[model samples]
Target chain A: MKKLINRQPGRVGQWALGLLPFVLLIIAYLIASDARLAANANDKLLPALNSFADAIQRMAFEPSKRSGDYLLWVDTLASLQRLAMGVGISALMALAVGIANGTIPYIRATLSPLVTGLSLVPPMAMLPVLFIIFGLGELAKVMLIIIGITPFLIRDLQQRALEIPREQIIKMQTLGANSWQIITRLVWPQLMPRLIGAVRLSLGPAWLFLIAAEAIAATEGLGYRIFLVRRYLAMDVILPYVVWITLLAFAIDFMLSRYSRWRYPWFHQQGH
Target chain B: MAIIEMKNLWKEYGDQVVLERLNARVEEGEFVTVVGASGCGKTTFLKLLLGTEQPSRGEMLLDGAPLPAEPDESRGIVFQRYSVLSHLTALQNVMLGGELQNSRWLGHCVGKTRKALQKEARAMLDSVGLGQAMDKYPHELSGGMQQRLALAQALIKKPRILLLDEPFGALDPGIRADMHQLVLSLWKSQKLTVFMITHDINEGFYLGTRLWVFDKPRLDPQAPGAYGARITYDLPVGNCEKNTLTRINRSVGNTSRAINDTL
Candidate 1:
């Protein structure tokens, strides 16, 4: 007999084990929803499953009467666009600043302390300031996400670059590599996979900052739509939106990890 | 001519002395193997030869001139680990030194230049017995194979001096024997001046034309770093009688054995 710590399920059993919690949660939700509907029939807090289906159909399939656009797709597109812009700019900045800070002593001395200080700042606290300056436009929302995650990404990449073995650097130097060659040929390629990993970790916080910004002031976005329906206690609409956002986040993370594995097989080998 | 000459070289870091009063003259095509107890500055000596560390208090002349402050293509180094880049295939790793030298900005060459470099790199890999594994990444290759790739990478530059800091220390006994043969052949054919550091006295004697032993003659109990290691014995290989081996082994004592046991 195996000890509890040593025991692990086989493939079939593992699949069943993984699904058990989700199945239990679904059953619990169904039962809770049935009881709430039986008692009040007008409970918005725990809407019946059919109400959620109806909300999804309305938000995703039907065009709005006033706007004549499918609300869900429009909201998703707007949110994704802002998220892409903020994160893209952050990635480029982190790569340059992080590699410079990691590889060059002068740049590291000049910028490392500043980056550390910026990371220590609470990005949420800057939201009001950002809004006042950038005027509640898309820039403010994007800036919040950038301000929230770029410092962290830069620090992560800097540490990753520093973690490159000292021997490798010496070996390259002995091979007649100049400073620029070492950075472009060695450090840059090495940090790309790490950058992807860092971005994956930052995605959760990036989403949080993005949603917060949108919730405060936006015409249409997942967060804005969710907050707008809160006065009506529209749990069906809110729940569906929340689930959709989560699915999107999961899909993005999955794809990024897959891409990293595909592109940098060597990095994944070290992980294993 | 003496390709490298160290006149009373010393290396110290802050209050701590690492090596002191070291003097040696290594000629071209000479294989010098260094053996010492841990913290005896064998690696520091190798770094000095590789041009990564400048002598703190003495002069190191290369080819009748002062050694460069930084490492360059005239010398190449291979460590026990991280000698090969993980991102590059075995072929690309060999070509990297050449590619960087040819192209100033991009560190890559294209078309005819690329083809010529590729052919040269393939030949270098073949010389190191990694011809079939040219496409493999460093992680995919075995430890011995990876070291072979590392050797190929260093040799591609046609460096006059090769500094190996226990390049085969991590390998198994069988693999180490194979590497020894490969290295001896490379040294003879390339006419390279080799400086290798090893813990095994037998390896030092077997592989080197000249064997250097570093030890500290003075020590203070209160301050461990008070005295630094010096080249206590510089013996020519093939002429060191049995008694000399016993004397060195006895003096090196449990420290060398401890290092070997851990390995």
Candidate 2:
């Protein structure tokens, strides 16, 4: 919560600041729309504002739900499932492959140049090639995302693993811990914070790719629905679809970052 | 066996030599304290004995064999810092060394092995006067308590040789003296061969059966910084009051004064 102001005048000033932008926009709109609406006040704004408020309220209530009719839509179970499975599996694979690259010096040396070379190859250019290999499928979508995401995961986690305290390494060595024990007990546990951040960042790109993936060849999902609307120029459907995607993205980030905080409470002990 | 011996040891970094042509020995079940002023290679010298660092020009023998790649069950080290795994309880930290000696396969075969390790760890903690602190993390404990935990962690394996690197440097004065007494008692009770580093002259003078000083031997004749990093004091440990003890103190004082005035 915000620190509430003490004095009534001071409180009013702060609240006025909060309302300023919306107030200014409304005032401008009312002045313009008033002339258009002189015959009837409800003709200018009430229906649109009421519908907008309803959409927002619907979103606020069942945040975990993706639902229908309102502009704030992730508004369906199927769309949420596709996102959860797609992003969840891809991010997890990225973490595993990336951690391996970062931890094993030899593997990193072997894989990095190839990855760097491949990264330069445009992802869209591979779409035709992937269609032949994967046969118009989910495999192509998930794989495309995995490729897009693994490098970031590998780089961030590698950096995090590298930054583990030197003293701890020495202590583990003195404790007679073998290399595997050190990585499993020390390195992986420390990777939780950076891993969560990596997952958060990758979620945005994953969603972007999901829409692209679904836009290509899907049937039932949000992207497919948006594509159907695009054929008819139904801005209502397309705009609401985008609004819901953004809402879902915000929810995804909030939940994972919350989990990151819970799992690694000592993360704030760092300089940040 | 002398347990540890350094023969004509030469440790160097590039063109600068740290410990040059130095011969040292440590007997089984004895306490030796090495002390020196700043930059005296006191730490590097101990690292060689601890098997953390290798002597560039010579070899060290432990228990009649060449030094192992890792310091073995026969030797344990207490570093200058707590070096206790912060995530582990004090008891867990103490139990860590002994646990390392147990094979994971064996533990898997036998159920409830942690309870056994916990019991042994508790015994070691009791000896270090930290039995009550067994459940706390190193960060939750004071520096003195942490060192005591480190001491237990080091000695729990019942290693024949114990190496401590300025273990009391971070403790308050009162804690330092109390820890010093604890170290003395533990050494006497266990009949443990101990090697320690100390900056406090009184500490070195009191704890060591014999004291060695480290000074950089490469200090330039005309320049200030080129002096040897450490100088050894191969004298016996004693207090100030007795006749023999007083004589030894005067000799140590004179030698220290002479080194101060000269190099």
Chain B vs. true chain B: TM-score per candidate = 0.94, 0.84
Give each model a TM-score.
Answer: 0.97, 0.76
Per residue, candidate 1 scores C-alpha lDDT tens digits across A142-211 of: 9999999999999999999999999889888878888999998999999999999999999999999999
How good is the docking of model 2, by CAPRI class?
Answer: acceptable
Worst 10-residue lDDT window for candidate 2 chain A reads A66-75
**What's the CA error at residue B202 for candidate 1, in Å?**
0.2
Regions of candidate 1 where Cα sits further than 4 Å from its true position: B221-223, B254-263
For model 2 chain B, the run of ten residues with the poorest summed lDDT: B103-112
Q: Identify the leading candidate in terms of DockQ.
A: 1
Q: Give the true-contact fraction for every prediction, in order.
A: 0.81, 0.19
Interface RMS deviation of candidate 2? 3.8
Best by lDDT: 1
Identify the candidate with maximal TM-score. Answer: 1
lDDT of 2 by residue, B69-158 (tens): 654456677777746766567876777765655643221112466678878889889988887887876777888888888888877777
